[model samples]
Target: MSTAGSPSTVDAPRTAAGSAGSDAPAPPPAPRRRTGGVLWTELRRGVGPWCGGVVVVVCWVAMYSKTPQWQGRWTETTDMLRSVALLLCGPLAVAAGCWQGGRERRRSTGDLLASLARTPLRRALLAVAPAALWPPAGYLVAAAGCTLATWPYAGEGRPFLSHTAADAMALAALGVLGFVAGRLIHWRLTAPLLAAVTYVGLGIPAYSESPARWLSPAYQHTYFWDRPVWWFGPASMVWTAGLAGVALLGLAARRRVVALLPLTVACAAAVVLTHTGDGLWRPDPATARLVCDDGTPQVCVTAVDRKLLPSVSAALSGVNARLRGVPGAPDRWIDGPRTPSPGREQLEAAPGAIVRRVGEPVLLGPREAQLPSPFGLAERGRVSDPVLYANWAVSYLFSRNCPGSGVDTPAARRAAAVNDAVNQWLAPRPYAVPAPLPGDEVHLRRLHGMGPAESRAYLARYLAADLCRPDEVPVP
Candidate 1:
């Protein structure tokens, strides 16, 4: 009792511990006690997460590098994402799925898994889940990242959610098909080889003109201003999902006849898409509708170009100054298709003629002049020198659609020189004044000699004169 740490005391404590352990119910088996069970084990330890990480990295890097090309337009942004999903994401998913499918065999666990009481289809489903599902999850994350980047600056339209869903479905199909391929092929390089082959397969149809090209998920789109038909996205989903379902059934079903249902569904979807073709797109009324600026000689642009209205109005200030209240001048400067719409009067000042189609084919109706489409003039939100375009517009108004307009004749040539001189005075080019044409220097000096008011008066007389008829043209 005096020696408190004796062997007898230690043995007493050990005996009590053993008695407590024996009295308590034994701990449940490790499998029963596991947090997420065996499926979690497969997902946690597999390479699937790495594949998803790879997808996000590739998408982010590609998208970041070309931000200017797609950032300000919802259609452009969605298109860019779709392209990446088809070209890069599809291949990556295939490769990752293949690797995952072959992992059990690689680890010599194929025999153990085969001997398990679970059916082959159930075992395969558990194995394929990480491969088939992870890629789509990764794609959604990537799409969200792109959307966040685009929302602040995107103009005039909503995100193409259907297109995004179609692309994700395509990626899942690719992953499932890849897993099937891997389960069948035992070669170590099968995953990478399948990826390369799949890339070529997806690409070949993109450049094709055949309607069958629509069957491929990689098909290109047109017109940032155009919207896809409402059912196009859902139909695309059915097409891709049916294909993936068929693949999965083929790999795991004891009765492969079950695959025919998905196969038939996929065939029907393919047919519908092939027949639909470009009919899938329609002009978006919101984008195609005209938005006008409050300015003298009122500037009008399509709603898609609403943001550019201020800059455009500012750019045209000099031209408006010259043309305002001038006889035969345009009343409304409108931007869109070159061909005039029905019931709309187009003031086409061809040198010898001023063709106007008012309600009664006369000049009395409000004059609507066709302005060049601003789409080509601006790039990545940076507008080019507007003065250059203004110069062209003025010169176009001056040019005569003579029978020999295309040919360079002496009289036509002289008339062109005079026309060029007048254009120069109206809208000065920002840079590189070309060496003067015949009589160009003289005309320029004469115009420069007059006061602004006198010059403006002279310009009016010059425009009213038919430069196509040399006798009708006024001397500067």
Candidate 2:
């Protein structure tokens, strides 16, 4: 006999008689298969993620390959690689997390899996398993693919070496953030929104005038290159840790809805609590401290090693002399070339004068640096350091034989005219040529104006200088 709806004796399995039983407890039902291996199985099912990884890698290869910078020394190419990685890979990781999380939730598998005997921690990890492994795998594949693509084109040091060690670590952190996001948000709508918000928050301010803006992920100074700011190391760790914590907490709450509300509230509260009323992050005083060369320049004009020191010195000297020749030159001083060790190469100068490499100039100075804006005439040419500007000035002085010769020919003039028209349409601030034509060589030499050496140097260093300004900083 059995209670209503319960299995009756006839339907139930009959126990063996006492003699067959031998007091052995019925095998305990195989202990209900452990859920530990779920993480492994889930991770194995990340083929879509792998394919996505492949797509990202392909894009990086294609894009970076097309950049003019990729054609030169392995060193520059590697920096570009790292910059592209930092700029692109982070968002991709977040996207991976969102996709995997949404799929699991949409399938209703998360609820089913969570109902199993597995501990919540194991369950959370299992749910995030795909994101955890795949994004990093994607980053690794992207990085490796870039290195491989660049290998045949490399002239010196392994192209991979040109990429900084920090990139790998940053990518790993990106992956973890993605994985954590997957575990926390199960809804399709919320997952992507959350990821986007996080990404925007991390990147928006690195370009801000405030030094604390360095807290922004985009502020990872010297993106592909190197910049030494010990402050960023700890800040990055803290931020990553905080994000990881929030992600885990969101996963472990009693209910998903309840878990989510707090994150929004916390973010709101932080905004209120930290608000300075100003539109920018607070500047750190240390930011003003000029990192000096003191014989060991990390990124300044004097940063060049002894082997290349002579060349760098010669370039600086030439620039100073040329500028002095200007009728009303600003006061000039060639501070010993100094820079932070392990920084993107640049020529530092006092505020009024732009200091840059002759062969390669840095583009970090204010707009005033490009004084007399030579518009609708020569396009931005091989202008790097002040020395290079001198070189360019001299070169331009020589390029023309007379007012209508060389680049002054009818075709050249027509091209310039067309370019000037196009520039009018594209420029945020349209400008007209100051003179009907660029000055002749004689005029340029006499005026100490923009020269040929400057053009050549600009051509060589153009990419580096252009890339130096933190993204979205609007070339200052």
Model 2 agreement with the true structure over 43-141: per-residue lDDT tens digits: 777643673465467547754655444533344445455556555656665666666656655676767866777677656666665665565466556
- Which residue ranges in model 1 land beyond 4 Å of their true spot? 1-30, 33-47, 187-193, 337-366, 376-476
Candidate that would win on TM-score = 1
TM-score of each: 0.74, 0.47
Residue 59 displacement (Å), model 2: 6.1
* lDDT, residue 173, model 2: 53
**TM-score: model 1 vs. ground truth:** 0.74
lDDT of 1: 0.77
**Whole-model Cα lDDT of every candidate shown, in order:** 0.77, 0.43
Model 2 root mean square deviation, Cα atoms: 15.0
Give the alpha carbon lDDT tens digit for every residue of 315-417 in model 1: 7889898788877677877764333332235655433443322211112234666555554455444346688778766655554444445666666667667
Alpha-carbon lDDT of model 2: 0.43
